[model samples]
Target: MYDFYKTISKTKIDIVYLGETVCSKRKLLRRDDWLEIAEQLKQSGKEVVLSSMALIEANSELAAVKTLCSNTDFSIEANDMSAVQLLKNKPFITGPSVNIYNPSSLKMLAKLGLKRWVLPIELSKEALSDMQSEKPKGVETEVLVYGRLPLAYSARCFTARSHNLPKDNCQLRCLDDPDGLLLSTQEEQKFLVLNGIQTQSAKTSNLIMDLHELINLNVDVLRISPPSKHTEKIIELFHKTLHKAYSASEANRALQKLMPAGGYCNGYWHGTNGIDWQETTEEILCQLS
Candidate 1:
């Protein structure tokens, strides 16, 4: 992901989420640092959000959650059930990592003061439509429009252990590969990326060209996960398309230059394999050109 302050200052992004969502061990930015960054982002005319860690284990981790919940300056996105419990009776954004699979759960969270939710990487358009149909009043839906799908998180630091070290003695190996260390099959085919304890897809999930479909679904926001580089260009493409200044094909071509590879997919949204891409039709391509 890009540097939080650098990105917020550079882009016309509507919302900026700060905090370590992957591994809490990543202490490059402390809680106070996040709050400071949030303050800076607020001044930049963006809605600032603090994202809770996806995996919370120890009491210290729980304490971090408490601090964020108690802070009244900005809203926080609860990623775990513990965070949800801590923030219950108070309004907060429910992140995709939470188990919000159906309308009942959505309503329950809404009752608990959840005003917004990011759709999980696995949810399809049909499911989203069904949930949106019965959403509680004032609840908004945001989709994981782009990013390396964060598949799973573990307590063990796989990246550290790979270099023959313990979790506590990880020695900040993760920083060496800012985008996570890639893992390939025995046959040399690239697969997953090891980011401390978080496992992400090797291929980044890009959805800039799916603006039409997202608008049709009535999605309120399209979340682009922070990339290590070229984030400004990616956001600009989306910013242009969101305002009808750029066509889908133009956005798609711009994204090719920003991805780790030329890989693009929207299979999860279409209810197919997660790696599938719904190709642009001839008429749509012609119009874009």
Candidate 2:
């Protein structure tokens, strides 16, 4: 992924999140490897945030969290409350998996030295507006503006079960499914993707269509979770949308071709179903015209 780091460092995205934020069992990169990649990203003039593992179940995992927290050089993305406690008094960012649903919780985290907070993907735009109304100063808001939505995490490895292998003995087999192991419904419709212990939505949440609303909400950062393919292209598309170089409909058209087979969804943004797609007024007008 160092090659990916080099590619994104040249993109228009301001902040880059490094480090593994999901299952800790997948040890593709060590702590030093992450720091070295962090240096490379920082050298390319990008703000780097070290992301922590979301589910820390073992004592060794806690030890890893301690190591990441003590780095002191780069800011960290607190994925769990334990991480938050470790990050107290330090300027750190909160990942979307962190249950920061209410304004009271937001205020409490702000007091604990949170520099920024990623909106929980399930929270609607209206909910974010209400929360942002009472958000503390100096705490920036980041939206999961692109990529597959991380729906859930579990201690059990579903991918291992697929191979009929025990979780412990299952070789790092998930690496074979780079994007994720696609889980289809009984109806054969593409449902969710299993990435180790994390379950992600099959539909990519493309919010280039909602850039206006985000800007109006005063969202500080727009986060695009990396997919296996077209990572740099997606970043460039977001850059174009952010700069008003492409209208939402035009960008949506261009983006549709780039999406994975399951396609895009923004139903959560509209406060509806998570997996459904809701079209914009422009797209509707285009359809009629």
Predicted candidate 2, C-alpha RMSD = 2.3
Per-residue lDDT of model 2, residues 162-221, tens digit only: 999899987989999999999999998999999988999999998887888898889999
| lDDT of candidate 1 over 1-289, digit per residue (tens) | 2264766577878898788888777788767777777887888798998888888889988898888888888998999998889888888898888978899999999999899998878989899999989999999999988888888888889999899999888898999998889888898767788999998887788777667778888999889887787777888889898887987777887787666853667788888988677876758746644
TM-score for each predicted model, relative to the true structure: 0.94, 0.96
Best by lDDT: 2
Off by over 4 Å in 1: 1-4, 282-289
How many residue pairs clash (N, CA or C atoms closer than 3 angstroms) in each of the candidate models, in the order given? Answer: 0, 0
Error of 1 at 198 (Å): 0.4
Error of 1 at 51 (Å): 0.9
Inter-residue clash pairs, candidate 2: none
Q: Against the correct fold, how does model 2 do in TM-score? A: 0.96
lDDT of candidate 2 at residue 169, scale 0 to 100 = 85
Give all candidate RMSDs, comma-separated. Answer: 2.2, 2.3
